[model samples]
Target: RVFEAMLLVGISFSPLAGDLVTLVAPQVAKAASLVFLLGAGALFLWEINAAGRWVWPTTIGLGLDIVVGTMALLATAGMDGGIASLLLINLAAGGVLLSLPKAFFFAGIAVGLQYLEHLLSLAWFGTAERSLSEVSLFAVGYLAVTGLSQLLRQEVSQRQQLVEQRESDVESLSQLNDLIIRRMKSGVLVIDAQGRIQRINEAAWSLLGNPSPTRKDLTEISPELWRRMQQWRSSGRGDYTPTALVERGTEVVPRFVAVPQSPHHSAIVFLEDSSLLTRQAEQLTLSSLGRLSASIAHEVRNPLAAISHAAQLLAESDSVAAADLRLLEIIRGQCLRMNAIVENILQLSRREQSKPELVNLRRWVVEFVDEFRTVQPLGGDELRALAPETAINVVFDADQLQQVVWNLAKNALRYGRLPEAPARISVVARRLPETGQAVLEVLDRGPGIAEKLRPHVFDPFFTTNEFGTGLGLYIARQLCEANQATLELVSVAGGGACFRIAFNAQPETLRGDKLPEP
Candidate 1:
């Protein structure tokens, strides 16, 4: 469009079409030059055949432009006419649309010729020379225009560079986020202002058991979920909590806070597993109870022993019958059962709340593996650690951290073993570069969680095992969060599970703070 406009201006200014040509002294010369320019354009077009090679056509066009440019110079003995400026327009067009270097060379020629024409007319021709005042004004105007154009060009170049750089950054961040989401056990959803699905990360798609699709309307695509989300939004500010919406395939969508970055314009919604958290809480409660039971059992054992001794003495009496002896034995058996319950309560209550300490993560994980080996009965070969032994460190409650490790290791030992691949557990610690957060992962070669149960796996008292109080994992999770860390389930590539803990690299070591008594 710009090219066409410049061409029209050139034609209008040319003598053949202008009214001033009739009375002007240089009318004949101008008329002849205009004819030559027109013929050059026509011939250039003719040489470049239609529907054929474009290279020869472009070459011919550039050549005709140079020839006409030279003729226009001869026609203008003085630089009185604004013909030179037209050359600048052509140069810019050529540079933008064709090879940049070639276009620059042409522009250089145009500038050089204009300067030569001006110098020659002043030094020799004496044709239509300008007064001193006019000359000063023209020189100032020309320099000012030139400087302004250069400034604009520089600004345009800088803007282009900045835009490119921002695009690259956004792309890199997007890819990294996608990789992380795909490796998560929880589902994530992102909606636009109009409740349209701007993005659904890999986990969300997989959880829905759907193939990846792009640019779909959230409401039209998933009406149920969309309605639930609307309800969540309508619930007002700071009222966000995890809600379970039973969906197709028994899917549970947990409440995740929707951060309002814009004013009711847009936000992100995260769906985590509430049932899992509930299971964890149950485990914590049960474990506490178990510890109490154990303490009670210890306290009762002395009395129970005395009672059993007295019963034995009574049964041994010569007057006592065989039936009486059987009754005494039954009483002793019931006492033994009560003793076992007490022991469980004690185990549940036994939470080691020692002072938190800063420990080098590399050394700690190695020590933990060694400790696991001593307690667990491995048949023959030693298990290996997959990650590096770097000098990573964190300040955490050591006793609580130990319990977390123990539960993860024990779970792996029980469920991860297979004939082909013997049971193995790996404790790894690494830092997240973006957030500079420390993450610990315990990977196990165990049967991956079932899709249906994955969401509820952390609920307290929710056990798949007959003997399980289901409190071990729950307590671990609670302690982790209490210490300003996050315990999460990471989805692995193969049929296995990974439990990851994300904590601040420089965590507050103090455990003096306590929750208000209920």
Candidate 2:
């Protein structure tokens, strides 16, 4: 539409004869302006669908305006058609369409064209000798146009920098806000004015049972949450008290707090997993305090002592043959093994200063197993890891590293027994590329840990067995921290448990650097 109008106006104004009869090309110019106004409105509607691609239409419009202005300038060559003002219009149009650099270039072109036309007209029509004031007037106009164009360019450049800085700051702030929410014990959720959930945190996911609600609609995703939002909106309250939500087909209760506040009128919701976290922390603390030997001494110690005394008497008797004496020696050795466990409990209770150093876990575990096998027989039940061919060093205490692996293997062997199936344990080690961390996993097949005990399984003094001291896991956890690593008991499906130890093998600062790309 703008192209058609500009073409018509340029053709209508091509002849200079009309200026002799009239001061202005009033009807034709109005027609051209009307087309621009209407076309601009229509373009806005099309631009919405085009989104970021609207620059093309704007460029075409500005180009048409320039062509029309050029034709008008040539048409009024014999007289001033107030076309200089139209050059300013073209300058503004170009600036709006193409951006600062292109805008400045177009502004310079417009000024040059106007200046050239004025000079050529003065030379052709014998106006050069008319007056010094007229010549100075033309010079001042050219200078003013150039100065204004440069000023606009500088302003545009500064505005661009300011916009870029604002965008960068917003991104940084958004990430910081997300980190704070995730680390916070309280769960927070932000919703837009329409009541749609815009943001959620880790605690919120756990409380909501990792609700996999689609982002399509609020009511469909979580009906209970949808209803609470409606209630908060209707009540027009600043903050809503915590409300219990009974999970579908389950007795689990979730508490939620809703706050309604927004310029667009959005609501924010928060959830607290009060029961789960409390129970988990309590169990962890108790398990950390539990001692294994303290639980088993009354039941196993007396029977073990009787077996040791009998083995000693039988070994001393001359009537017992050498072959029979071998059985007595085995009995005494087994009894001594039980006594050594009590000593292990005492050592665990004593707070020892951690001595940290670079430890090669592969060599340490291998040496411990080799030395252990020289004194005691480990049958087919023993498991061996395929160590990495290359050495991977991690900062840790040598003795503590030995104890952590030993306690974990012994725990797995003791409880991983099977009645009808063969007992098997797996020891595996792998280096993670993302964080440059080393992971060691020990898996066993036995009865899986109960849901009630799972959370507190590592706490001291907490044990399922009557003969457990619970100190083993407690000491293991302490040793892991002393070695700058984390030890966690992860429940395995089907049966048994897996103990995973994660240690830093290399220094890293960026979280993205620690995450492997999919």
Candidate 3:
């Protein structure tokens, strides 16, 4: 429109175009000015009415451009006029607003109109020879402009789509990363160079004692941790020892790692529970012990067997004196103790995979007690089975359960006897109504374990008795765990020790059989 207005003003002034307007036919020149004015007025009206829509405006605007260009060319009488190139602008606009086929359509129309104006000039005024070559050259130029414009527009569209897709991918990846970090078991804390907390996960927040710590400095939370972190950072070593943060009786192991490629000087601090570290260390020790036990049984069993045979031979010899016989007995007892230790270690090393089966506790306990009384006659009536009137079913390895019960029963018979009541060990089997779990308890009348020794009772090689191998209870507990049971010592009412074996009860393990009424 601005170009059209400038052309109209130039033709009106007659001086800007080197007085070419005056040299041309006055009526043709006036007609060209009217066309320019009308085209500019239509464009202004189109823009005002089609404020938001562009398809119709673009189509009409391009049409007006072609008409004005053709009229200007005719006014100057064909090739003599320099207005032929003005058709290129209309074709370029069509290429930008429409598809390739539509832009080509406009290009075809402009070329045909140019040729028509040339033919009209030749017929109306006795002009020179018609130049079909000039018309062909102009057609090629118009098509070239339209093709280049469309190519540039397509390239811009493709770049914009690529940018949007990359942005969406980046956003999705960021959200996934944040979700993983938040749910991770290990505590993660991001700290800046200024020693302030930038971000902390739930685990880290709980490890910090759940303080309302928004952008709080590390020193304010724990001076010891801050001091250790600063020392680690200054040391410039990748492998620094973890430091302990002991606050309010809870200990956490803190490790610092520098975030690589971070513009701001920042570090990621990992806080792990002390108990979790201890469990990991314990697992490693158990693995090593399992290997060591295999070697010990092979190397020591043969020598131990020979020593026991020699002790038996010496005891049977009639030439041995009475005092010598006492020494022989002592040697024999020592040999037996050593054999028990070896057997226990071998059992730990070669533990069989647990095969669980549902057992009726009441009926099973009755049969077990009868068998135990035959083996251990000294307990006599002291060992009794106390079970619920109704049968309670529990899942466990029958052989493992037997070993565990025998160990607990033997311990109770040895240390659970009182001067007044010599036989008071009882095996009680019942279901805990509240938790729906099966419990087997060995209750004793003897003095209970001391508070200080209770924690170590289930530890291997932990025993108070001089003659004990100290592996019975530990092995028993380990076997119980393999069968998904827990063995813990609880205080019995009115003074005595009660070792409780709680079995995990599943719905499928429950038996429908009820005990017959007696």
Of 2 and 3, which scores higher on lDDT? 3
lDDT of 2 by residue, 357-462 (tens): 6555566556666765565455767666645766655666677777787788777777876775554766666676787678777788877567788788777556
The TM-score obtained by model 3 is 0.54
Evaluate residue 66 in candidate 3 and report its C-alpha lDDT on the 0 to 100 scale: 79
| Candidate 3 weakest ten by summed lDDT | 509-518
lDDT of each: 0.61, 0.62, 0.78
Q: Which candidate, 1 or 2, has the higher TM-score?
A: 2
Model 3 misplacement above 4 A: 1-186, 213-217, 230-246, 260-264, 272-290, 313-330, 352-446, 473-518
What is the TM-score of each predicted model, taking all chains together? Answer: 0.41, 0.54, 0.54
TM-score of 2: 0.54
lDDT of 3 by residue, 68-167 (tens): 6776666654324456766776688678777777777888888888788778867766662337787778888988999998997798778989999999
TM-score computed on alpha carbons, candidate 1: 0.41
User: What lDDT, from 0 to 1, does candidate 2 have?
Assistant: 0.62
Error of 3 at 174 (Å): 4.7
For candidate 3, the C-alpha RMSD (Å) to the true structure equals 10.0
Model 1 spans > 4 angstroms off: 1-70, 76-79, 85-112, 115-148, 174-182, 190-198, 206-248, 251-253, 256-269, 282-518
